[model samples]
Target chain A: MISRMRILDGTLLALEAEGMRPTAARAAGWRRAVAGCGIDSLETLLPPAGAGDSPDRASPVAESSSPPGNAASRRSAAPERPPSLSELIARVLPTTVVPSVSALANLASGAFPQSGWHCIYGLGDALFADRKTLARSIDSLSEGREALLAPCFTNERGCATALAVEWLLGGEDRAALVSFAGCGGLAALEEVLAALLVHGGLPAADLRGLPELTDRYRRMGGGPIPPAKAVIGEAIFSVESGIHVDGLWKSPDLYELFPPEIVGRERRIIMGKHSGKRAVLVKCGALGLPVTADLAERVLQKVKEESARRKTSLCDTDFIALYSTCRAGKDEKEEGGRAVL
Target chain B: MRFCKIVDTTLRDGEQAPGHAFSLDDKVFLASLLDGAGVYQIEAGVPAMGRDEQDAVCAVKDACKTAVVSTWNRLTEEDVRASVACHPDIIHLCLPVSERHITRKLRTTQAALLRQFSRVAEYAAGRGYRVTAGFEDASRAEVPFLLQAAETAKRHGIERIRLSDTLGMLRPSSAALLVRTAREVGLPVEMHAHNDLGMALANSAIAVLAGAGFIDTTLLGIGERAGNCGLGAFVAACREYTAISPLQARKAERLALPLLSRCRQRKFFT
Candidate 1:
């Protein structure tokens, strides 16, 4: 079995790092949406002080003359357990995927509260146990109705991929915990999501809003996304090679498996050292300066040499400058021909 | 399990990091260090970049005593000429097997790429040079073409097949399948993985488990974009399978940390 489907949003804790605070009303709505989407828990790093945790939200006790607020305060003062996000999420949802960065017995027990969590999320080899011992415990945990053993991962070697290997060995009942870009942050979330969709483990349409989530993190002071970060990189779809351009013009799928539109990106072809003459011809056509076949070769040679010297792709401005030079030479030749006539 | 050979490419692909160039001394230092760590091969550098690069590749071949020296080349005669200039132990020839690399990168079709590799492999092999044919992005290549490319190389006397996850898109399951399939063609397989999807170390490890005969790595996994598998980390993760004593792995970690930090100016996790 694929285990009961649930996507616990772990972004709340990462949001705290960016100094963004969720208002009480927003928190209540967010929690409601998460629950509605079948996510069993809100995996926040810090205890959520959201409206979902407000005393007014929980059902009130009977036989109390005091106002609902006073009775709620009285009950809060004599709590049976310390405040925990896992408990908070469990109260509203059917299942929780608790965050356990460590393997402390106290933390594990608290994170995986009885009759609440659907699974435990942590780095693969949660306590550095060998594969055999780990598999045994995972099997034991999964015995209950819809209890999943999810191994969390970052970009660290043997991260999610290693967990996947173990999961395949252990069977599909196991789950995987991963951030969008393979880290706790939102950057590269969409790209990583795309990879997962392509990797054949999850339904592509089931995933939503990786780019939007990443944007939210950036707005919260997480900083701009790394331009070359694997999947979501700015340059991932951009190509400059003549052959790439030729194939891309024929079919984008020829080079990249998924459409850039999958992640809200577009294809681009810039002129560079590895560029072919077709690229030059295309650029010239775009500029409305149709080049003769001979001129195309000369322009392409110049572009390649200059890109090599610069050790980078030529910017549009550089291409324009080259066009201007060629255009001026052509104009002068035409004038000389007129004078000869 | 086959005893996997370790080929460190820190000086080659690692140096290809955008806007980064390593001096001769840095190349010599890394080559010697990897050699001391018992790496079976060191892909020193790309001699085809220029004469200076060729000279540096030559210098690396001379600097290391234990590890066999090699240079990376594309499936072209000019590049083979450059590798010839270096006079190294193995001429590592590369051909793009995926439709993307063949059509876009080389502007050639699969048939053309196969034809080119046959001629290039023959040229290098007939010269009495030890040749290793790398199917760049073999993970994305059509299965039939990949097998055909391997068979052609095998026919041309290529000694090894380097199956690279060029885009780093390979998963452990697919990696095992690809490596196993390539082995059937009768050539030893090497796993050259990228960390594009953050799966390099894991993919390499799984490939080793699946019977690939060599694992490609770079120190700190520093290369283009995310980088290749880190030598120290790969050694640490597969220490038992690779047969290095824990003490030796620890020593390698110690030597790699300082140089890696100096190279990239960050506290790299690997």
Candidate 2:
């Protein structure tokens, strides 16, 4: 029944934290891409002076504007008395920006100044805690205020997204703080969105822009996206094994969770050591080549042998060459059988 | 927290990916690393492929000191006979349990498939092999049929049941429900999660939390299409839920880095 939700993407902050300074142009592209995916807002970590660019200059969707220099430097400069939340809010209010503060549950004890801002309470070690304890902790922290729970683990281990989705499903309706590709130890924005779209009644069109967004992310100096990466990997739609290819041929829904077109990808049949006759037939049909069962079997055998020897799937050129050889062999066999008769 | 067994399938299912073909040496080396990292079992390879694959499985079994070596097989006597030649500690039989896989892919009815599985399970069990049933495409299966398959496994002395999310279609809630329901049959459930929708790791962890006894993993999540759950990431993710030692998890992560780097340098992933 939860309807109202917001997604705060932290891809820009994640890039900066990884020591890659994204240009204003790249930032603008990133913003446009995410906006197309229906993201509510973008979160950027304000870099120090002369950091080469500013997200405010890049896009108007960025909601927070903090003082220059990282959080660590600011905290170290006034170690004797750290700036309170109210003091930081006062500084951010002059710029007409509602400050967004991220803090752990332990540090988020006191309350004050009901200003128009959101506080992201980090789940920290409580993410590893048992379900009951974790739920109690979440309820206690966001009991009376507009607090968004942030599932921040140390790495992109599996739990952050699951924790975020669980909170979104079972906990109260609230904004979720996530990062693209799960950078900066936050829940992955793509995964959370996909989950909501598929299981939580969100629009399927919300994810059609993931492929372009991923490409833009790579151009922004993000690390190489693993081909097997969930939601956005290029190779995810490629089918190789016999059972999978057969299942997909019968019905894509049988073997696929969602259609590839939903994420702007196409289904591909790859010829490999595990390729079956059905896969070869499907590939041939897609290539606009007509073939009988006999030809398909011969071509399939050759495809398997060559793929096993090469230790990789065959390209279309390789398959076409193998098909020609098999066709010639079949023709010779037919001529011999006719002569014998 | 319950201790979930780690079943490293890097040499078997991980090799099924298009670009990966591990040599005999690579198999043994990876098996040794997994053993040193305290993995509960290693699914070495499918023996029905030929002598080279059998030799690789045998080599891995000989190289590992603590981890048990297992072989993957289809539900048939021929596949079981091939696995027996490798002398693996466990024989895993993969069964397609979903209606689509049962009627369409397998071209058989549910009862017939289960009958085939029963005959094969009895054969493997009679050979003094520890048999495990892998319900392939179990996520799309009906709950009652899945439980029936689990019951059949238990009846035939099958050691464990592997619930495979073959299409990586499960969310955490569904994964937890599947694991809990399977646990009701009084058999240890192992999760074989795929990452097509990018929820493999999350589903695997949630399965563990929901009473699954084992989780399957690959070195860098390499497998068919998107891949299976990653070994290093899964260990790191389930640290609080499972009794895996932190030191052992660190060792696995450290070994995995160089191995992954080597694979990357060799252009295995393209």
Candidate 3:
């Protein structure tokens, strides 16, 4: 079974980044939404914070009455014990097509999550343990549920397509099956989501914001959506990274051709090589950091230095750290002197 | 050189060869084949031609993923609007840069043509389109006028400019010089050469090496008269020359060849 703690951690992180309080319902909602939308591992799903004790650098917990925000303390907290493999089998075996010998061993051993749909597309040898593993699992599944399998025949892979079609047909149980079309790769993911959201009892209008979610998925996979890609292309809202972030921020609606809520994402200011000083200053004003002409210049210089050192374009965290460092400093020398490394 | 964005205009301009025409399904099948061949851009059609052209553009736009879809437009605002209706990412606006064509075909003074084009381009830009302005017959245009047109485009914010050798009159050396001149004006250059003298591919290669970021090609080199450079042939040449890296060359061949073959196949079937 997928570790509940890991799921919780991922949900909490996505929630925190989205600026929502980490209540149980919010956590569950995020879980349900993410579970419905994708099949990536929990670690792969959330935006990475940093390597090794990178310090809880998310935007200072907004309106915090509680000490040590959820992320701050959760990082050091003990890992929650995951439900045993047998326990997971007991919970999910009832939802599969057939329950057989080897399937019991794998499910009881907790190789897969107890709940939530699993959609694996492309190269099943790498993604799934083996076809036998899938067959055994299908055999062990309970009645009234079916597992969809599409084989790749003659260079054309039908596995992903068949799974997707079954997932759509499976009805209110809401479990889904999906396979990759080999040619489309991750390209078909959005179409799958849109098709599912349209035909699978999902609120279609609510899914109008799916483009942003798909964009987030693309970013998570480290893919660049071509500037002209529909919905979430770089050129749509981005006017050369930071140079236009504030302008985009002011009229987020204008820049937002797609709604933000469908995939539980928000438009953010990304600091990069092309960010304008006015944009930085404006961002500072929003973050409650006082700004001046000299400060903006200093910030820009710091950004350039840090970005070069890190070998990445400046991100929101870098901007926040610079602002936070400036807040703690008394003079320009102290403000500018901190090592970016 | 960096990975150049190769645009095959085979289905659009290729089909425009004197005795050639592609049915809608033929166009879609050819576009799909091109999509697999790994081209970076496809100038699909001239939408202002009619509804049939617009339909071809729509079908290709809906299905293809390997390359960005673009449409060719003349320097008129009406053409730009018509092209916009089909939703191509890049609208390639063409204007005659040569004084001979400007004085005769356009029946206007050089200064008047420039002003009119500038106004039309400004409107296109205001609409937030990525405009690629092509100087039709650029190789024969007077150097100063070519420079002026390019400078005018750059000053008015055109993203890319093309130097079309209308009659394939230039050799590789002249193509290189013309491309260098365009780049000297600080605008990205795309080379569109005909093969009247069987030098389109050679000129394209030289132009690319001289800093042109884009090259236009037609399938099987089919076009008016002796046709343009064959896109598949140009891709192979770029690969052999290592003009672009192995990865991109491989990608271009994969994305462009199948569509070209499909087009040929459909022509046979029809």
Candidate 4:
């Protein structure tokens, strides 16, 4: 459950590519377009590798480049290239800001639409390498620096924290770039919200928009994002493993930061390789399946085997099949269904 | 600052994602692309899966013109025989090093495990295929013992040892330290990390900095559970931070990544 005030989302570009629908304006009218997601001209975002391109994009994506000394690649003279960002952005709204200094420079030079576009200067540790020059570039950008203020975060790696503090104290209008998860940005976002709630002279009323803010984020990430992703993965509420499952079963608050209902997700007892009998019993009980102790243990072993065989946690179909197999002497067959509660 | 070689196990580890198995054609296509991208080595797939699997591995080996083709296996002659039949350049023989895995997973003593592995590595060496021993769950193994195991495997003709953070439990600092410690065994250490904590990238970077000669990665980091370090992410970071060869970065940039729809499909967990 998200117990923070509000976090500016950086998922628009990612979500747009996934074809997720645009959400309504938030209560605060803040745009859901990620700060670094919007592009001026997708083609010109990165200079082409050859003439108007970055050196990396010099090769055409269709013509695969074979490594040197290989007869096939020796014939072609170039390796297969990765899809350009433009090609990738074709399906989605090209709203993500170009975090690279080079791409950001291109963005600053290009003419962007007046409305629905907010320029965020993406800065991570790379800024530290040339802080003075990067700072000068930002200071020099005359028109849209006000719109710019996207800081690339890499965990609590000090730089992101320092930049956030500077923004808060220096009165910069920039929003802290919060990745829904990974690179350490998720926890940082919570910290930022906590600080703002306490220090920034903002009232709790201002913080009420976080849930809506979170919904906007969900919209950008598309439907049913991975359950285990750090901040955004739904797997947070779905407990697996014996120790944590037992603890959570004993006291809901013992393991989780908040209730799963807060995030519109439910606490699932997933029977996995490391799952204890409690997880199996809970999941079975929820599905209204009655089983003796031995049956539960048998079902659990089957689940672990299937999970290990498939190299993932068993889904609902797997659970049902296992339960049915345990109940009767019949063999289990793969079925396409899930254990959704 | 030394350059690191990449062995992409997308086909093998990536395919391990629950309900995600690529058709042979997809495997061949991905192989061609990865090879063309100058990926140093391609751990195509574990041929031990079966005949069709063997044929798939052979097809990838035949299709590639440059990338070194390899296959994974357990510490057993039957799996090794399957690996040999596929005709890969390297046979990756995996053995558990951690006490938990040795006791709970493999249910064997360390001495018995080592002895059995030596036989497998020796058999693989005699078969004219280069052998790389994977120390499964090595991070949990005692440092000195792990190095000793590597040295013993080295003596048995295993050319390399892959240090797997099998459970994805190592911190970046510990990952680096493990690589540094494994360096004493005098064989190239390949870092095979999992992403349980989303720190696979950080751990991979630290391994590169700490002198792991090779990094085991998958395209899009598609592997078990949280997945492996993404090939694109690892290459991109390397390009930005280190003096890595531009060949890799260029290929990574231009490679038509599988669409998010495919990646996001619950089946494939990249």
- Give the chain B TM-score for each candidate: 0.93, 0.94, 0.88, 0.92
TM per prediction: 0.70, 0.84, 0.41, 0.56
Summarize candidate 1's per-residue lDDT along A1-341 as a digit string, tens digits.
43342233444434432344344344444434333322332222222333133444322222212111121122335344443333332332323342333342233323432342343433443322344655454444444444333443433334454454345334543344334344442222343344555765444343334345555455444555554455555544555645457656666655465676765556666765556777777778877776887777777767666765654556677877776666566656878633211
What DockQ does every candidate get? Answer: 0.22, 0.46, 0.02, 0.04
Over 4 Å off in model 4, which ranges?
Answer: A1-179, A182-341, B240-256, B259-263, B266-270
Q: Which numbered prediction scores highest in lDDT against the true structure? A: 2
Clashes of 1: 2
Candidate 4 local lDDT, A210-318, one digit each (tens): 3454555554453544534422353334545554466567655433444545334456666555567888888888898987787788887787677656545666777
After aligning candidate 4 to the native by TM-score, how far in Å is the CA of A18 from where it should be?
18
What is the Cα-based lDDT of residue A8 in candidate 1? 38
Instruction: Output the lDDT of residue A201, model 3.
Output: 30
Docking class of 1: incorrect
Chain A TM-scores in order: 0.64, 0.78, 0.33, 0.45
Which candidate do you rate higher for DockQ, 2 or 4?
A: 2
- Model 3 quality (TM-score): 0.41
lDDT tens readout by residue for model 2, A231-320: 887666777777678888887877787898888788878787777889989989999888999889889889877876765667777888
> Per-residue error at A200 for model 2, in Å?
3.1
